[model samples]
Target: MFDLAEIIDIPPFSLDRQKKGELFTRALSDLTQYHQQNCHEYNQILQLLGGSKNSFSSIEDIPFIPVRLFKEYELLSVDQAEVIKTMTSSGTTGQSVSKIFLDKYTSTNQTKVLTKLVSSFTGKKRLPMLVIDTKAVLKDRNLFSARGAGILGFSMLGYDVTYALDERMELDWEQINAFIQKHKNEQILLFGFTFMIWEHFYKPLQSKGLQLPFENSILIHGGGWKKLIDEAVDNETYKKRIFEVTGIERIFNYYGMVEQTGSIFMECESGYLHSSIFSDVIIRDYKDFRSLGFGEQGLIQLVSLLPQSYPGHSILTEDIGELLGEDNCSCGRLGKYFKVHGRIKNAEIRGCSDTYAEGKK
Candidate 1:
């Protein structure tokens, strides 16, 4: 069995996704076995569920943490000193959420995955990445939130271009225009959350009748349209608006959280978010944990192989998604491509469905 401590301290220097997945599977199985032996909470859950190492033959067998647990528990398997940074969710002012911690190696591995995944998708070695907000917001030490963790983790990828750091996250028109002018011919990558880019940046830019001077510019945003749903935008309208404002063909949406460090499912050209190497996407029926097949929409349960500081072997996300199954992506990546339809309103909220089914594939 591989040592959990060694996995964290050493760099997993593999570029091949399948090989990386093998390493992660083995390492995490060791960690889970270790936790089942050491951590009280983990041990209890395993005992109750009749857990065994054989259960994790595939990613779908991994147990997922309810997103609400972070809000209720300390939720760290490592020592306090080992935590290099803490990130919180940007849900609202008083209702803050926290993701425990990140060690240097964990953070570095996460960045490496981001760079490789994004680079492969955009087909550009490095697009001039424009920061839509402040660097401090990216890696705050204050509270816990998955959104904070995501943005902060992204900032580590040394991107070019001036960052907009207004407290309100409002973009300065002149600065944006000047930056566009400086790299007029370069294909730029604009990154931000769904609401922030839509309400603050896109709308304002479109209203000004201003467009960037690049042909291959792409904008990548995460989170759901729930924030814009209140405004009655809907999915089709939202995508159209993004295309209109960005003036780019490659507008991508990503599905991920702070809990699972490196694995993120990114929206490809075919309008589906493709799963990364470090994780597997399983669509469990809304009420039951039984696995659903392709074209079926249900509660999205992610089995992540990216986490190290915690027991993130499996996490049942509040997001609702549809699995498209394994197929040839036009982008050339193999594996199942899934689309996130939307997220359950709150992390703890459940749908009104019968929990009669319980089967695994």
Candidate 2:
């Protein structure tokens, strides 16, 4: 078993490309064998790809299951009795959702790695948080949708947590203003899915011509950019409009999924999503699934050290992205950083915010 504690102790972005690659290759290779031995379906898939030989010299040598497999099959490396929580991907009325099983070990380490990755940007202290979505999302505890899991996951980084919208997806001005007034002098944190922040929080405030009194606050949002792209909104415009309305200069958009929840690639001041020591992103050719060099856009394959309860260690996602560079970001981070273009065209609209928008239609 590859103990995650060894890498968790290191600073999230401290490992350079060479060092991180060596560690990841070892850890993920071990996880491959671990899953093959414990998960029958995973073993069968590997056997079909080739023989069930798990030894691999490089990260690219490891085979990855399509991310959508979780939607079609129950792929568990651990026994059903060991699952502590099941996380489902966000989907509309008839769309199938991915189900991720988590045991105590996987669950605990997910939080631990997430804390380290987020703290690299937010610092050690937990700030007062105002979530842009309604509190109703967190109602179901055991089976969590990606939206709810996202809310609950990021909520751990803040204190005096508050939701900015009501159950009807209406902006609660009174409550939001009160929260701002109470924490007016402190540095606060705001989180939400990308579209929800735009539709529920930003658009409402913009229409009302209401500016918040958040002198020092950071807004962290993710889920997907499909809805925003439909509106022709780019990252720069999103940040500019948000700054105009809220005066929040520090806004970060992270890239992650329910399958690889904890190992998020957070955006830096340089506007690139960075991979931490515990996780990595590889761009693969759309047709052949071969690894692409930096600056080439293709399907995104995500690998993380946090998924032990299930065979989700390395997954080929439907999203497309291009690797910018490694160990040379202007932000001083020492890992691979890249930009997410969006989901593959004609792919199912399944992001948390995107599904919410579809349901409304």
Candidate 3:
């Protein structure tokens, strides 16, 4: 079994493109055997792809498990006894989905992954992070949530700057003001989903004649911007508005999903989200699986080397992005980095109902 900590840590795996390719080759071989031993669905997928234990030589050559596989089966490459935590996607009413079967190794490793990504972007071992909810995570003992755990894990590491605001949601004015006011002399790091931060925090601050401490501050937001597409906030417009409010010259956005536990793509000062050596982002042509080149946007496919608890080492996702090559980013980081255009919301499939599925695929 691969020890999750050895390969990934706070700085995030930083091999050059050549070494990264080698790492993926090894992961491809190991994950193929692990999947055959534990997951049945991918076994069928492997057979279809003409893949075997020896067939995979590179990460790009490996077969990709669809993101929808979480809705189909347990899909873990580990024993049931080792299972620890299952993170879920927030489904609408009557529909909730979960990615099951995480062992202690997987859980702790997830914390490390998130920690590394967050720290790298902010350059703060403990940033005064402002979260949307302050108490919901600490109070909810009955429900074990992966998303919540992921956020709380990062927040706990830093200064506990999170607080409550509304009845169901938390927006602590004092804490927010205090963090901003104190951090005015330093770089501030703000974390949340894109829509949530824009709607709840940034928009309200604008109305109240407030702005973030610019310059050293960096905003890290995840989840798809599908909701904001119809709301008419283009990336430039959104960034400009945020700049006006926060006065922060640097803004960073990330692209990631729960399935690939190892790495995250972070936007640098150059304004391109760069992939770590531990993962590969494929800009697919439409829904077709074959890889697409730069300047073209299509379905985003992720080939990750970071799944020990499950067979998500290589998975395809519904997001879209364009590839910025090794020479593109002004920041010195290597490997592929792409900007997300938006999520494919119209890709929702109907009539196919599953208990684990929170929404239409």
Which candidate wins on lDDT?
A: 2
Model 1 spans with C-alpha error above 4 angstroms: 1-28, 94-96, 134-145, 345-361
Q: Flag regions of model 3 displaced more than 4 Å.
A: 1-6, 9-13, 48-51, 94-96, 137-147, 178-186, 212-215, 349-361
Each model's C-alpha lDDT? 0.63, 0.91, 0.65
Clashes of each: 12, 0, 5
Residue-by-residue lDDT tens digits, candidate 2, 1-361: 7999887789899988788889988899899999999999999999899865657888988889999999999989999999999999998988899999999999999999888889889999999999999998887899999999999999999999999999899988788879978887899999999998999989988998988877588999997677788899999999999998899999999989999989999999999999999899899999898999999999999999999999999999988899999999999999999998878888888788888888888
Displacement of the residue 224 alpha carbon in candidate 1, Å: 2.5
lDDT: worst 10-residue window of model 1: 352-361
Candidate 1 lDDT over residue span 89-199, tens digit each: 444434545455666656666776776666666653566777665555544355535655555555544366466546656676667777887778887877777766676
**Which run of 10 residues does model 3 get worst, by summed lDDT?**
349-358
lDDT of 3 by residue, 156-218 (tens): 546756553454444677766776676668655566666666766767878888865656766
Model 2 poorest ten-residue lDDT run: 49-58
Leading candidate by TM-score: 2
> What would the TM-scores of all predictions be?
0.82, 0.98, 0.85
